[model samples]
Target: MLWRAISEELPGPKWAGLFAEYWPFYRKWWLKEGEPARPTYAECRRALKAHMPDLIPLYEDLCDQAGGGDLAARFLSFYCPPPYLSGCSQAVWGGKEPVMVRNYDYNTNAFDSLVLHTGWKGRRVMGTSDGLFGLVDGVNDAGLSISLTFGGRRVVGVGFGVPLILRYVLQTCETAEQAGEILARVPTHMSYNVTVLDRKRKYLTALMAPDRPAIITKAAVATNHQENVEWISHARFTATVERERYLLQRLRFHRDPEEKFINTFLKPPLYSHQFNAGFGTLYTAVYRPRKREMEHRWPGTVWHQKLDAFEEGSRNVLMPGIVA
Candidate 1:
């Protein structure tokens, strides 16, 4: 997989200028053929401003900086409703001191996606997808890691997107409980399976949506749907059953997970080969909160990044035999 990585914080205007090149393509792709239809930029902004009023100034600054006179909607693109259907498989291993590993799958046509090693003022954060504003999965300097998958449904409502909520948890919370508390408070426009992990071996999974109450699940691995799959009649992804089963079987086989064992996801079941749309396995994130380290992985090779010191730029990651 090819990905662009950004380090320094580019002011709002500067990022707007850089983002100009990719705007036209995404702006036209508001609704793909089979995707869950989303609201217009105006509708999305109205919901976001009403729910997360604090982000308005930041959104305005970015649009104002982009230098395009009629670009308020352009900057608001960050909060636009994302694909209501995406695949992700995440698991927390290590009996004594758990580790969080995840594979994020999505439609490539929907986003001008990239990895971001943000230059936040208070906490150090590294996120996958969206260079500056939002995040799909990420780990913070405080040893808290979080990731999300679409909650197999087609309901959109008055709430914030899961990415920014993930960003907020990383920015403010240090413990898994704290992260969970914040997640409990926010309402999401769509459904998502969000998991948060901390060094204390505390891993929390929240099955959330704007229309329904959040269901807390007592499990290590979280796929695309809620814990109770019997209630799922409208999920977009049908492969969740196989994906969840494969990972659980692997875990049972490997009682004590080591570095080599955790790396198996670079292959099948967890790592995806289908790249036609955006559902291909973009990157497998292996987060070791206790060690304060993370691996940006490919098929055969991996880049090691630490909370204190990290490599901050774009690079190709490849591991020969692992690219299945």
Candidate 2:
């Protein structure tokens, strides 16, 4: 995977170039069910205005950058687009440094492999980019960090994609409490568990679903499944139960130092290598919200960045067969 980090204060040529590059794949996927099967441009715009009012201006700006076409505009809205799923594991480390970490497991061919640092709307936000503007996980200048995992459900409904919701959280919220409220209120088209951590070490995991109200929990660990494993085949395929139990054991039975705890994710069931299954661990991300520092780790390689001084660069990581 080629991971590129680009810093842009606003939507411009850089973002436009990304849209130009990825739009082909996105357009094909968005229209997999045909154009009429998706929401109309008017409906998409209305959904954004109603749910993520603060994002309208930015959305429009990006739409213009994406050529201002009706199809591009609706796609950028990310409102009830196609249904997607991934396997991930995330948790808050209460030991020290206000850290949150996770391994993003998903289809290698379908990822953007980009890290975006932007000062949009006067807030400095940086993280893994998805759908050009949406974020899979990221942190804001306000010392707030957020990440997500598949909620282990197969139901899809009328709501925004979780990536856009993650973008909205970092763009507007400054603390875990504030993030929880936004996670609960926003409607997700599928099931996803979003975890937020603040500078003060306060954290919560919101199990967001379209078929039901979001459940806010103080639990520190979140894997693929929610309260109970709803999709048995998916749960077993992803090893969601086993992974969750392993993380909980690490947090409860061990007194691992900060470095040791982080390393644990680099090994064993946490560091998955099932790319062919479309849920391999692409990268492990570690976030220190208080310090505004984040690291993308791939076996022996580690690239660190901070909000105070984010640099634009790129690295090619060999996945599925990484040497630790």
Q: What value of lDDT does candidate 1 attain over all alpha carbons?
A: 0.69
Q: Write the per-residue lDDT of candidate 2 for residues 7-40, one digit (tens) a residue.
A: 9999999999999999999999999999998999
Model 1 C-alpha lDDT per residue in residues 282-324, reported as the tens digit of each score:
6778888877777767776676777667665566555232334
Quote model 2's TM-score.
Answer: 0.98
lDDT (CA) per prediction: 0.69, 0.92
For each predicted model, how many residue pairs clash, with residues at least 3 apart or on different chains? 7, 0
Q: Return the TM-score for candidate 1, rounded to 2 decimals.
A: 0.82
Candidate 2 whole-model C-alpha lDDT, 0 to 1: 0.92
**Where in model 1 is the C-alpha error above 4 Å?**
9-14, 30-50, 53-57, 68-82, 95-97, 230-238, 317-324
